[model samples]
Target: MSRYEEAKLNYEKMGVDVEGALTLCAATPISIHCWQGDDVRGFDQKDGRAGDGIQTTGDYPGRAGSFEELKADFLKAASLIPGKKRINLHASYAVFPEGEWADRDKTAYRYFIPWVEFAREHGFGIDFNPTCFSHPMVKNGLTLSSPDEAVRRFWIDHCIACRQVAQRMGEALGDKVLNNIWVPDGMKDVPADRMGPRLRLKAALDEIFAENCPNVIDSVESKVFGIGLESYTVGSGEFFMAYASQHPGVYHLLDNGHYHPTELVSDKIPTLLCYFDVLPLHVTRPVRWDSDHVVLFDDELREMMTEIVRCGGLQKVLIGLDFFDASINRVAAWVVGTRNAQKALLWALLQPHEALKALQDSADFTEKMVRMEEAKTLPFGDIWREYCRREGVSADESWFEDVKAYEREVLSRRGT
Candidate 1:
C-alpha cells in the first residue's frame, strides 16, 4: 500500500479524518502581514522608516522601497505559500496618489482603493490595523491615552478614519475586514497617575467605537511593554479583557508575543474560547522578550494550535501572522512563518480530539498518555507531504530553493 494510504488507515483507527483535516487546513484563512517585506517600513513615510517601537534589525539588501515593489514582493511571497491567505494592513501602509499625501487623520477610502482592487485580484480577504506607532503625533510615548489632548485627538480621529476605510474595503470585497487597534501608549517610567490615562483611553475608545461600521470587526490589542516604554503599559491585558467583556462588539486581540515571557498563549486560547464567541490571534515567536521573530514549527506553536483545535476554536478564531525579521530573506521569512503556522494547525487537526477527550473524561489517563505518545510514531510526514502536493506547493525543502532562485533573479536586482 502507498504511504499516504497507510497513514490514512492509521489515523482512521484513531477516529481522525485525515482528508477532512487537509480540507480544513487548506480552506482556513490566515492573515499575512505586509510589513515583513520592507521590515515594517510602510510606504506612507518619506524615508520609509518605521521609527516607533516597531523595530527590525539586519541590513537586508533588497528591502522594498515603494508600494509597487512591496506589492510585487508580497505577490512573490504569497505564491510560495499555499491555502487561503489574506493580507493584513496597517493604516501606515495606505497608498496615496503620486505627488499627493494624506496624514493619518485625513486618510480616506481613496487612499486604500488600490489595496481593495489588489485584494479583488488575488481572491484574498483583507484585514486592517490602525498603525498607532512610528508617527510624530505620539506625545511622551503615548497616543490614544496621551496627556496632550491634541495628541489624543489626532490618534482618535485617525482610528475613526481607519474604520471608515476598513468598512469601505470590506464593502468592496464583500467580506468583513478586521480593524484591529494596537496603540503603543505606555511610559518609560512608572506613571504617577495610571487611572487618568486608562480613563482617557476608555473615553477615547468610546469615541472611536461610537459609530459602528457594519462590515468592520473592531479589536483592541494590549502589550506588556515595548522597547522604550518598559516601565508601564497603559493598556494592560486586564484592562482590555474587562473592556471587551463590557463591550459586546469590541473583541480583545491576543498577540502571542505581547505578553509576559512565562505566560502561555496556548493555555489562554482555551480560556478565551470559554467566553468569547470570536477570538483574534497574532502569531509570532518571541525569544525571551516580545521581539517579533520568524515563526517555526516549534513546541509552543504546536501547543497553541492544539489548544485552538481541542477547544473547537477553528471556526471562531481569526489567525494572523505578525512577525518581521529582516535578518534573513524577507520573502522567505513570510513563507517560513506562514507555512509553519499552517503546518501546526494541520498537525492539530490530524489528532483524534474526540477519543482523547473521552479518555480524559473517563479518567483513563494511562490509555490517553499511551495513545498520545503512539501518535508521534504515525506516518505524519507522509500526510504532510500529501497535503503539500494537494496544495500545489513543494513539501520538502525544495520550496526554499525556489525562493533562492527568485532572490537571485528578482530581489537581488532591486534598489541597484
Candidate 2:
C-alpha cells in the first residue's frame, strides 16, 4: 500500500477522517503579510527614514525597493505556498501614480487599485492595516492617542481613509476585507496619568468607527509596549478587550507576540470565541518581546491551532501571518512561515478531537495522555507530503531550491 494509504488507515483507527481533514485544510485561507518582502519599509516613505516602534532586523541583500519589486517577490513567495491564500496589506503600501503623492489622510481608493488588480489576479482576498507608526505624525510615540489634537486628528483621518479604501477593495473583490488598526501610542517612561492616553484613544476609536463601511471587518490591535514605549502602552490588551466587549461590531485582534511572555494566545482563542462572532488573529513568533520572528511549526503553534480546531474556531477566526524577518531570504521567510502555518492547521485538523474530548469528560487522563502522545508520532510527514502533492507545492525541503534559484536570478540582481 502507498505511504498515504497506510497513514490513512492508522488515523482511521483514531476516528479521524483523513480525507475530510485534507478537504478542510485546503479550503481554509491564511493571509500572508506583504511587509516581509521589504522589511516593513513601505513605499510611501519619501523621507527615507525607517521609522520607529515597529522594526525589522538584518539588511539582507535584494530588499524590495519599489512596488514592482515587492510585487514580484510577493508572487514568488506566494507560488511556493499551498492551500487557499490571502494577501494582507498595510496602508503604507499604497501604490500611487508616478510623480504624484497623497498624504495619509488624503489617500483614497485610487491609490490602491493596483493592489486590487494584483490580488484579484492571484485569487487572494485582501486584508489591510493602517500604518500608524513610521510616520511624521507619530508625535511623542503616539498617533491616535497623542496629546496634541493635530496629531490625533491626522491619524484618525488616516485610519478613516484606510477603512474606506479597504471597504472599496472588499467591494471590488466581492469578499469582506479585514481592516485592522494598530497604533504604537505609548510612553517610554512612567506617566503620571495613565488614564489620559487611554481615554484619548477611546475617543479616537469612537471617531474612527463612527463612519463604518459594511464590507469592512474592523479589528483593533493592542500591544504591551514598543521599543521606545516600554514603560506604558496606551492601548493595552485589557483596554482593547474591554472595548471589543462593549462594542458590537468591533473585534479585538490578538497577536501572539504582543502579550506578556507568560501568557499564551492559544488559551485566549476560546475565550475570544465565546465573545466575538469574528475573531481576527495575527499569528507570529516572538523569541523575546514582540520580536515578530517568522513562525515555526513548534509547540505553541500546534497548541494554538489545536485549540482553534477544538473550539470550532476554524470558521469564526480569521488567520493572518504578521512577521518581517530581514535576517533571512525574504521570499523564503514568507514560504517557510506560510507553510508552517498551513502545517499547523493540518496538524490540528488530523486530531480526533471528539475522542479526545470524550476522554477529558470521562476523566480518563491516562488514556488521553497516551493517545495524545501517540498521535504525535504518527507518519504526519507522509500526510503532509500528500497534501503538498495535491496542492501543487513542493512537499519537502526541495522547495528551498527554488527559492535559492530565484535569489540568484532575481534577488541577486537588485542593488544594495
Error of 2 at 119 (Å): 0.7
Off by over 4 Å in 1: none
What are the TM-scores, per candidate, against the unseen true structure?
Answer: 0.98, 0.99
Which lDDT values do the candidates have, in the order given?
0.90, 0.92
Weakest ten-residue segment in model 1 by summed lDDT: 45-54
For model 2, the stretches where C-alpha displacement exceeds 4 angstroms are none
How does residue 265 of candidate 1 score in lDDT? Answer: 93
Error of model 1, residue 293, in angstroms: 0.6
At residue 51, candidate 1 shows an lDDT of: 66
Put down candidate 1 lDDT per residue, 1-416, tens digits, no spaces: 99999999999998999999999999999999999989888877776676666788888788887788889889988887878999999898888887899889887999888888998998989999998888888778889998899999999999999999999998899999999999888888878998999999999999999997999998999889998989988899999999998998899899999999999899999998888998999999999888889999998999999999889888889999999888889989999999999999999999988999999999999999999998867788899999998988988888889889888998899982
lDDT of 1 at 404: 90
